[model samples]
Target: MVVRTEWRLRQQSPRFKPQRRQAVSLTSRWIIGLLTAVYLLWLLVRTVGQPDWLTQLPALVSELLRLVEIGWLATLLVLWGLVWWHERQEAGQRLPPLKLEELYNLHPADFERYVARLFRQKGYKAAVRGRSGDLGVDLVLTRQGGKRAIVQCKRYRNTIGPDIVRELYGTLIHEGVSHAFLVTTADISESARAWAQGKPMTLIDGPTLVAIARSLQLSPPSSPKAS
Candidate 1:
């Protein structure tokens, strides 16, 4: 009987990716909006009052106003589209089916390597932190537009507790990184959720891992391993 091997080189976990934060804060947006309004109002005043400088450029003033109006509308449309896209991405965190058996068969060291690959598949500058003294960080992920986020993978057979979450969050604060995550093939305790709340920490449980693996649709290894 042929035991069809069912492992794929899967990477990219929806759990590891953060829900995009507000790229533009409200205060900055308001400040820019106010300044634009003031400038436009001043321009209108100058044109209507026909100031000496304004009188010399009657045609140019009208053309500039028309261009400004068009530009303003275009800017609004772009901003709206960006916001819509961000929201859609945030809402698209659906879990998909995965070959759980294959993932379960991975050795602990292999699991770390696999997790690193997953982040890389998602376009992160990712690497395993090495076994020697990593300060509890297993993987480090970076991107051009995002701050470095550290990851810790756990291939445990049981649920974890709040202390694990606390440790990761503490490391995030101490290192001052932008984000932190804990990925495990197990559930977390209620106290764990309590600690992770309102923090830049993510706790990815087992089922979530399966979904990310499924989404990756990875290819199996080229050859069978020696027994």
Candidate 2:
């Protein structure tokens, strides 16, 4: 039975290719636009014709306006739902499905480890600090016969503000590190970015993190990493 089904599917493969839907004719579009304009004009004329009705209909108009507001809100909700659904569909198409345990295992610490490994693979001697203490940094990376860099990793769900950047900058100065990097899976706020600008400190946000991961060929986390 399986063999027969396989044979049938193979035979039908060419017939099953999707075809593009035809575009609406220009005549149809013109008719739709004309009808919509006429209906709107008629409504305007009808509303103008009844002055007494209009005077009495303020309450009704208010109620209709409320209903229109509700309709607009519902339309916005539906559009947002559609956008979310499309994003989910695209994500599924672009990546392989992950298991729950695999997702659960993806932690900020794991990301730190991955980054360290990547740096090491690139011939930079790197280490992940288990705790944020007097070490004055999170990841210490040393380039061969080059400057030693200190990286501060901020895994936040929301935007990393200027406060964290300021702290790292202070630490960088205190430690006398040649270079400093503040990395996060989330974005840094405009103020935070501006604050770090021209300060001899590097700020790596979501896009930069993703780019680095791609460059290093690091696997995607099963679950979303904290920003």
Candidate 3:
């Protein structure tokens, strides 16, 4: 009886929200294409075989106008199809952003993957340097029109201080790169924050990182409960 009651309640519950509008089915599209082809063939036969059809206008002018209209319609349809395909390919390539809960659970290696994905979305070539002998750098990002940038991801639970920031500032020299970024899940000390001002490197704390993630159209991080 309890199981039966639960089943009844579940049946009354709302369905899962669909993420995207359903695409037209292959069969439906094929049917439409077939009908359009048949219609075009019929029009061609009528225009070619019928001598009195263009009585109001020269047959050449009527045929040319019909051809022009068909060309315009075909061009529009091709453009529309290309746009749809590009958008679908782009949507598939994007990496979903991390939630706060997920961030808190991520290992350092996974954090590097997350940051690398963000750079990828922005059209930068970014590679994780790995945990061993990374020389304090997690990601090395580069693009043709941009500077070669080094990223250090610190997924610490506690506050990261100035020492790490200074270390990353020094890391650029060792890596032979001009730009460096210190990305962390934890907040920074005021002294560290102040020290970063006017420096060559940038420090991104948790809140700022979340803002960046949102701006990139990645999944926005969920707010964590007050500690």
Candidate 4:
């Protein structure tokens, strides 16, 4: 049974928060285009009816041609410049695919984010906790049907011991979640694995983490929804 407390409720984070998108109305665009066309048609009619229209036609056409040339040249230059700048930005933002070897080089906070993202991709609603005084909890995951789980990430090269697993178990009790996850970049000690048996906790090591990553890459992920 899970214990419910005010503090535990406050500690719980949301999965994916839904955001409303702002839309532009097609009707408004159509109305504006129609108005512009009508105004241009009216001006053309008024210009053609003038008494001096025939006498001034040559000079008027020459001036209009010059303006159109200048306007088209400036517009083309601006569009070309914008395309070049956008291409440069896209080039700068492109990232290489994640490799298993690179996980060892990531910062602790980044490691936590990576774990959270992996869980999210696997169809869980996951949130990374704040860095300061999180009480050993790195991430909180809420699966379908409102089952909550806490995650702790360890980017260690050395094997994890039972002490750490015991501490996370205590945190799980405090958080009152259905389960807990401990993700590490190294193997769990034999004692640690034994200590976690029959508990509402799962341990994930380096190779397992890579396997999960590869599996997700091969299979399309289901969209994550808030529980």
Say which candidate scores most in TM-score.
4
- Please list the residue runs of candidate 1 whose C-alpha ends up more than 4 Å from where it truly belongs after superposition: 1-98, 218-227
Clashing pairs in 3: none
Alpha-carbon RMSD of each model = 14.6, 20.4, 15.4, 17.8
What's the best-to-worst order under TM-score? 4, 3, 1, 2
Tens-digit lDDT string for candidate 3 (22-86): 22322344555675676577667767866565557887898896897687568657755865575
lDDT of each: 0.65, 0.59, 0.66, 0.69
Model 2 vs. true fold: TM: 0.47
Q: Residue-wise lDDT of candidate 2 within 15-108, one digit each (tens)?
A: 2221111112223445545655665565576576744654567787868865875675566556556545643443332222222222123354
Which is the winner by TM-score between candidate 2 and candidate 4? 4
Judging by lDDT against the true structure, name the best candidate.
4
On the 0 to 100 scale, the lDDT of residue 11 in model 1 is: 29
What lDDT tens digits, residue by residue, belong to model 1 across residues 97-180? 334554555555666666765565555655566466777888887766667888999888778999888888888887778889
Give each model a TM-score. 0.51, 0.47, 0.54, 0.55
Evaluated against the true structure, the overall lDDT of model 1 is 0.65
lDDT for model 2 comes to: 0.59
For candidate 3, the 10 contiguous residues with the lowest summed lDDT are: 14-23
